[model samples]
Target chain A: MASFKQIHKEFVAALLVPSAPIPKGLVALKKPNITSRFAVYRNNVIVGLIAALKSNFPICFALVGDEFFKALAVDFIRKNPPTSPMLFEYGDEFAFFISQYSPADQLPYLADIARLEIMWRNAYHAIDAKPLDIAKIQQIDAKEHSNLTFKTHPSAAILKSNWPIYSIWQGHEDNDMVDIDLEVKQAILICRPNVDVLIANIDPAACIFYSAIMNGRTLGNAYEKAIKQDQNFDFNYCFGQLFALGLITDIAAEN
Target chain B: MSNFRLKKIPNLAGVGLKAQHYKTILQEKPKLGWFEVHPENYMGAGGPPHKYLTAIRELYPISLHGVGMSLGGPSERLDPEHLRLFKALKDRYEPWLISEHLAWSTHEGKFFNDLLPLPYTEETLNHLANHVDEMQSYMGKQVLIENPSAYLAYESSPYAETEFLDQLVKRTGCGLLLDVNNIFVSANNQGYDAYDYLDAYPVEHVEEIHLGGHSVELIEDDDLGIGKLLIDDHSSAVIDDVWDIYKKLIAKTGPKPSLIEWDGDIPEWPVLFNEAKIADGFMKKHVSTKVKS
Candidate 1:
């Protein structure tokens, strides 16, 4: 007789690994056919997990087609089942898995696309915060602004990749861009200032500054890093773009 | 305990509130008893789920059905984090009724999100009862434990499924949610008396009823195409057999709050709304029959 703990371990093992036989002592003695019946449980588990991934990564699903995507998702699920019940946070590691996935290597840019989708989901579900009043930033004296530190929106993220992921993302939205220039590098600033999630293409300098503030660095230090990344980095232009997007929710200045 | 007596739900039928149907539900204001949502769907930070749910909730009563609680987890401790999320949703919505499956979806720090059946044994019964008791207490309200649609029965199980549920009721003072579709599907797959399972059920304590669709698949290479298995895929309209069983249960137990659940391949608003109306029609017919008798 299997203990509850033992049975669950075996059952989960059997569920994830399709080739593994059903857990011992799980067969119905009265019923003649148990394997096919057991397969139903496997089908339900795999199908349900696949559906979650499919919804999360529609672009990936479309690019790979349904059959290939299901197979890919099944492999990922077998390796990494969810730790928490909240499914919105379930696929955070999927993009990482896709990057390392051996079979998906042919389409090198597929993993970055998955990353963008995950970022969109994160922004969609992040804590709602009121964007800082623009008037306050407008009134900041020249010297005071230099030492100021700002807190980025709870859901703000910067995804920098060598592939043109934004164009790939746009192609999926029915505005099909026939030819994607994959050689060019791209960086997207993801934020949900209001109801709709917003994404803006930014330069490497802006990515450097965004990463600095997200790491709780002072504006003065972030500007130094941004300038180091790009000699032509315009603090005013980058700041203006971020302010317009409502990516910065709060700020503090050392008087 | 909000009275162990069943909570009085409107004697009308309802449907699972899906996001696609939100706009039309608010615009048309479909005649629904109450709309149910999986609390997990609303757990997101902000946006449309709140916007439309707020509008629709005002017009119709709401019920919270949970899919990820892991009530009967192998570990003694209930997942505190999930409970916290659940508590927040309950405080916000104040749904008419909240229910979770009797089975566990999480174990050993991993979750499957599918309702996995349990062996009917004394150890399993006691563990589940304690979990339910703790859950109801933590929620500051009683919860109805829904019986799962079983795929395979354990031969080593000492107690019958009904007896195990009855024990939980006796020990923890929780209510039951009878999924009629589940009953039919499980009976057909496991080769049991569907009505007999219902007869042995604690129907008096059944606070709610659920009706959904299922598909039949023939098992291969077993006694030369000897058996058929029914999968409870809630994607299609309610089948005739499930309707017959639901009507029989309604006739026996009288009218209760029923929900038309079309989880997958959800049809347009009118079709799903009509299914709810059909359920309501059955309830009205049962009432008229009682008056004639």
Candidate 2:
């Protein structure tokens, strides 16, 4: 006489843990043997969640190959079953998980690759907004340019990584054979300025500047932060890229 | 709430819309009765999924078949966040038919992503009926609940699957989406006659029908009485035995809107489209034969 709650608790417990025995009260029609039958659900739960994870982190899957990815993904799925029902939102913590996973320490950059993929996915589905045209910025008085604050597009994001993640991601995207320099620190700007998601490599200085503006810093303050990182940081280059990519949706001059 | 008009999807064969097929569907505008999508897929704020869905919605009718509602969950109530997102999709798309499974996918705030089975008991019935009622009340329209494909049965269950569903419908005033392949798969796995399950089903309340393919695996132990277990993978074409059951169902229910759902190992657009045509042929043949009678 298991209560519904008790039965469901047992059911879900076994579902997440592959080695757990079948919960009590489950029966098959023909014979008492329900092991294989129950195993179907265990397989479905694990396999289905693994599939969702695979779709979410395709680059991570590609880097590790199928076997390692499946094993790693299974561990991740069992440990961190999705809190949300939306499959697309399932693996937000996967990048963080990969960073701590010991087996993947050999490929230290794999976690950052997962992060870039997540960023691309987020950009793909981010809230749509009209990109601010250059004409809008041209109207801003030169004296007010440095004092102007910018509103980043909803989909815009900056990722700075110790590994050459942009090159690895680009190689996968273009299906090209490129010798990635592992020592090179890389930063990328990810956004959906229009219909398609765009991911471009950005200078480290620009990453700091973009991060500052995205954090609601004024142009002067963002530029100051960028120059602090690199004495030769080019403000015009950073501002040109932002305006060309339409990453800024609105700008407000300080009163 | 009163002015909401649930668009009527034509009673013809449709295909489960996949993202890969979106471009082809928009370009070809194939003569599909309607397109069906899992509302969870479109829950994102805005993107290609929405862009293509919007374009296709203009040319063809759409139905939202939810896979993550957790309507029969053990929790006290349905997930409010999921409900809000689903409601937004329904408002934006205005799908002709909205449906979810009788099984639960969430427990203790973790989503399993599979339509896990529930036991059939008076308490279970009451719980499911309340969930359904809440969904309908919030939706301002009836949602057809689909029967889940099962592999194992609960020993403590008191009622048959169909009887439980009938009770849920009677209490909640919701409709049913009969997935014929689920019947074949569940019956074969659970040792019940597919035709018998169909016979016991409350077909009068069925508003739409689903047709899909399943994968079969042979169990190692013959003494278990279950020689082959059918998995409703929906990765291939509908088999003849399932079609026979579907024909039998349509003969009784008379040409409900059926969909050819190939969710896994999806083939080329034409291959999936051809499967829908096959279903359309069955619906037409059954209807004409009934007209003759």
**Candidate whose lDDT is highest:** 2
Chain A (candidate 1) TM-score to true chain A: 0.87
Task: For candidate 1, write residues B1-293 as lDDT tens digits.
Answer: 11122323586898999989988888898777888889888788776677677777778777788999887778887888888888787777677888999888887889897888788888888898888988899988778888888777776789887878888889998888889999988887777889999889888888889999888888753444566788888999999888999999999889988999899998999999999998999999999999999
Query: lDDT, candidate 1, residue A160?
Result: 91
Question: For candidate 1, lDDT tens digit of each residue in A1-255?
Answer: 788777777777787777898876654426447777778888888888899889989899988898889889988988889888777667888888999988899989989999999999988888788888768877878677778888789888999988988788878877585898978789898998887788888888988988897788888898999999999998988878777888788885454
Q: TM-score winner among the candidates? A: 2
TM-score of each: 0.91, 0.96
Model 1 segments more than 4 A misplaced: A24-30, A133-149, A175-177, A212-237, B1-9, B221-224
Off by over 4 Å in 2: A140-143, B1-6, B222-226
In candidate 1, how many Å is residue B112 off?
Answer: 1.6
Candidate 2 structure quality by residue, lDDT tens digits, A4-121: 8998899988887768878988876746457787888989988998999999988788888999999899889888999887888788899999999999999999999999988989
Supply candidate 1's per-residue lDDT for A207.
89
Reference-based TM-score, model 1: 0.91
Task: Write the residue-wise lDDT of candidate 2 on B1-293 in tens digits.
Answer: 31234557888998999999988988898988888999989999987888888888888888999999898899998999999989988888888889999999999899988998888999999999999998989887899999999998888888999999898888999999999999999888877899999999999999999999898897854466438888989999999998999989988888889999999998999999998898899889987887899
> Under CAPRI classification, how is model 1 graded?
medium
Chain B TM-scores across candidates: 0.95, 0.96
